[model samples]
Target: MNLLEAFKQTKFQLSGHGNRNIKVLKDAFEQMDEQQESDMYGSGKIIEEFQDKLASYLGKESAVFFPSGTMAQQIALRIWCDRKGLKKVAYHPLSHLEIHEEDGLKKIHHIEPVLLADKNSVIELEDIVGMDEDVSCILLELPQREIGGQLPSYETLESISTYCREKGIKLHLDGARLYEITPYYKKTAAEISSLFDSVYVSFYKGIGGIAGAILAGEKDFIEESKSWKRRYGGDLISLYPYIVSADYYFDKRSQNMDEYYEGAKTLARLFNECEGISTLPLEPVSNMFHVHFNHSKEKMEQILIQLYEETGIGLTHYLNKTGEHSCYYEVSVGDRLAAIPIEELRNVFNLLNEEIKK
Candidate 1:
């Protein structure tokens, strides 16, 4: 079973978007504008406002909204490859393009992936220096997920951008969790985005939008992307629900993202003080971090379930297998995390460790 979303009852889930109640959507509609024009093929006041807002926020010439990040990125990269007349794109080995997309970028678009640096490591400026192929674009995930939300230093990012610009290789950011790291890096969305040729931010992940992504880039690039959207069946007749929800959350949750980052740092510190457990990066660079344990998956699962049943503190929904005798789980602090006392959470981790040892 997929452990990511499997839980009987969780007082405070460690990761994922808000499992919003049905009324949340109802409330958004109640507050929505009645005079707004409904988007037809991405041409309505509602869609245009959302797109323009994202474009300004990201410091890009234009922006387009997509039904999903998968569609947004696929088309964005396709446009890059087409303009450059190259079939190859570059990204980390474990990025969504490699693992989750199932080669949709390759199978459908026929764009090859030049797995950069290493399979399980962040791509560095030096990594691109030694590349033998002139690729179309380099896709980067801000605070690279699947690796504990680690972010490269701003200096390194700037250097990489300079190098990419010199080499004429377009840079794309898969900033699904961009807002989460904004506070950590001390940079606004546009400041960080200025380094990339194209940037994609998700509405649902960090922002708690209903479901969608905003792809931003130059006007011409975005114009080309719109055509791909129509071809890929992403240009829905009406996307007001996604638009309004994203607009609402972008204003609501984004304000507290920095608080979430601080909470993650505090949580990581407390966990590391315990024996037989540690957080990857030792310090969280974003709102998410990996809690590594020296125990079997079965043992951890049992303890997680037992603890949730007895204490009503759902520290984690599932543990990810890292090795034969090691596992890791992500802890993402949300508004619910603010309700529970930090001391109580620490106690749960301590007890979990003690139980696992036995």
Candidate 2:
């Protein structure tokens, strides 16, 4: 099936989710060769340079690149726990480290995650204040992706950061979607990252690159992570393609995240104005959000199939809290969606409603 057809066969998706405009192998190779080409395969000078540049951009002293965010974050927590001589890392109940990662942090790092918030809310200072002691680090995602891209209030975030500092707890940001959030928060990446002791940004998320993640922190923390990376088998031979594409995408689209925020708001507004649909988290925190439908799963599936077969639209399925109900679904707005007019998308919303009426 074509890309759009493949998407529609699964679920009704009005959200621009997933990476797009990824640099092809040819394009990535060309970009890599633009610099002095070297065949010595490994995370060498080129890869190290990319890490340094990314760390500087994120306002950290050093960074280490990994094959996946799962590895990068687990290692970050392990290092924090080791340094602080504590076993618990505080995070939201819905943080990627808790829900996603397949329990990697608990299994591999041997670190306990103190889930601090409920499913819908971002972790706040109130959540942390209840914890008395023995927490090594606080892991906060800027926009909680699973909760329909929700974010804590700015003042609340500062309060939480200050509280962590006063309590002698390190703060590590799971910034998988950090780029998409800066525009909505009216903050630069460095400014948001400055509040936390360490920050991790994914190359493949908003930057539209292939699989890779960067963990940024102090020089000592990063140096320790290097040994841990080697221990975990993340030392890839050569990250040329991943690095080149990440650099290109970050350089090109880093400035346009504001445009993406505007488009996402426009799309969310259209969906909110339409009947038969409700948006999760009440508002768009980033370029991602969820759309809960009143229709049944069968009806949703039919609508998706029809849209993809008729109109080349890509979408993904949604899972309910109990994993049994499937009526509701999610939409992720990204760079590819900037071209589609908000009014045109509203027409699809009307179509979905009309289909439900039938």
Candidate 3:
């Protein structure tokens, strides 16, 4: 693709729902008026107030706000490692900490991860049951991203939590998309969060903030994390942009999670019926899933090029790995793409199949 055309190449986009900037501004203005519009860092009260609200919302004794999810999570690990007097954390092979994060847990936190689940599968309790008692904490991602947002059965989650309690191991939730899982489990965020010792929620994922994360746990745990946050350079001078935007998006999208669930199921169903397109998890358990392309990457790129040149849809973030004959692919459904009618998605797939047939 030429430079100009390359810049315009977008066939489908993932997670486009939380773009209500006007609403966000309105909320910010309202909060400013109530609080006299003091600077964010001048008092550190803004972040503390936000933490209090978040802690109560997550059912934790306290919460700490950070500039980034990565830093927040690593700090959690450091704390767990210190508490248990163990250096290892049990997590899924596809866990964000394992595949992503640039090995920050190892280099920064000085901890090791015991891969708990087989690659390409949701984590199971059995995976960690046989581990030595020295395991510091168990990290659970509610919707396994690489596995098409698959989650372990609630029974299994309960079993795992029970085991953690029995073994006296810490349970930490990588709840970046925790809010999105509530509808799937038919549970409330507080209900689900109560099962874990500590929960980390992202403000930018489903919440559509500029960028921020909240780590919630017992008062002591959260207080300790603040020290780690400062040490890890996560303490920001002003988190108001992230905080204000997060608060707005939380209020706006908390009511629409069910709608997102419906959209995810619909898109997965439509993709299943399309020729040469397949999805992992068969059914979407969250607002994201993977779509496999049953054509060579060269052919798929050609189709993507054509689709973008002719239409404005943005699909597939990176190269797919479906199978030998067809390139594999995955699609994440979120805000902008979800707003489009179901018929539009079906039509796109229809055109894709027709082009492949040609």
Candidate 4:
């Protein structure tokens, strides 16, 4: 059978909280009151209270819920550019805005993005200091996701934040997996977020909610974002479903970030011990990291499909080709890793090591 089919048949998987099926949403709503009112086009208690709670948690004066981080972030850049009248921003070369969003920020807002740093490295304070052109905002992704969840040191973050404020450049955070990094830094979410002028966080990522994002900043900044949220057709008649799921999962999983972080380290060590396999960072800074295999994708797929059938332990269901002879996949540790028996997990890796060596 194919890799995905084998993964589906496995008795235990070694990534994510669980299957993101309708049951995920069903569980979130199971304890909710049947008569609870839904939010209306961004108003009502359901939306506002969650926004307030998240804003407070992130140490922002206000927050707005958006249907997606794509919409929230594009509007954030637009607002920053409008305020400075510069229409330009700086971010890492591998930013989601650059690689994944189909140039929505550029197409919709006409905001020019000045790519910084090499594609494979996290952006350092020096990269920002060395920019030749002036821009209104600087966007930083904590534990930069594209580069195997690598992170800049907290000191570097502080230096960058201080420099941006001194130069009147707004600092925006693409904190899609913000909570996942806090354990490594030993800081509160509010402490980390206070360095950025504005922050955008995703719900469906490390939080494992159905889907949603929160944009938090000064009251005026978030108020402006609400208008942009409407302009971007993000204001659905009722976002209660997304909001409720977000709230439920945030409470359920937020406290477990430290556990997940340790779980990631444990898993990374196993991958590293296997022949022809290694993980980026050597050690993970967050609950996610990339696993690289020296074998070609075609060969790795064959090996993994057989491994899954023999062991009923799924490590990953897909791979991304990096070179003719190399492939990789990302792993984010969550509740699922805890379900596998410890001895079984070790046996799976022991077999994995033997197979890769052959």
Pairs with steric clashes in candidate 1: none
Please give, for residues 194-266, the per-residue lDDT of candidate 2 as tens digits.
Answer: 9999999997767777778999999999999989988998876666667777787788777777777776777
Order candidates by lDDT, high to low.
4, 1, 3, 2
| Highest TM-score model number | 4
TM-score of 1: 0.94
Q: Model 4, 184-295: lDDT tens per residue?
A: 9999989999999999999998899999999999999999999988988999989989999999999999999999999999999999999889999789999999999999
Models 1 onward score TM values of 0.94, 0.89, 0.89, 0.99
| Model 4 regions more than 4 Å off | none
Q: Write the per-residue lDDT of candidate 3 for residues 1-358, one digit (tens) a residue.
A: 8322642465445445534466656665564546545335324666677788888889889898888888988889889999878898988888888878899999877898888767888878788787754688999998988777889888888999998999888999999999888888998888888889999999777666667899999989988998887787666676777777777778777777787777778877877887777877788887777777777777777776676555556555345645666776555455676656666666776787777778
At residue 284, candidate 4 shows an lDDT of: 98
lDDT, model 3: 0.77
Q: In lDDT terms, how accurate is model 1?
A: 0.84
Tell me the spans in candidate 3 whose CA falls farther than 4 Å from its real position: 2-15, 18-45, 321-324
Model 4 TM-score relative to the real fold? 0.99
**Each model's backbone clash number:** 0, 4, 19, 0
Candidate 1, residue 8: Cα displacement in angstroms equals 3.4
- In candidate 2 the C-alpha lDDT for residue 9 amounts to 65
Residue 42 in model 1: lDDT = 96
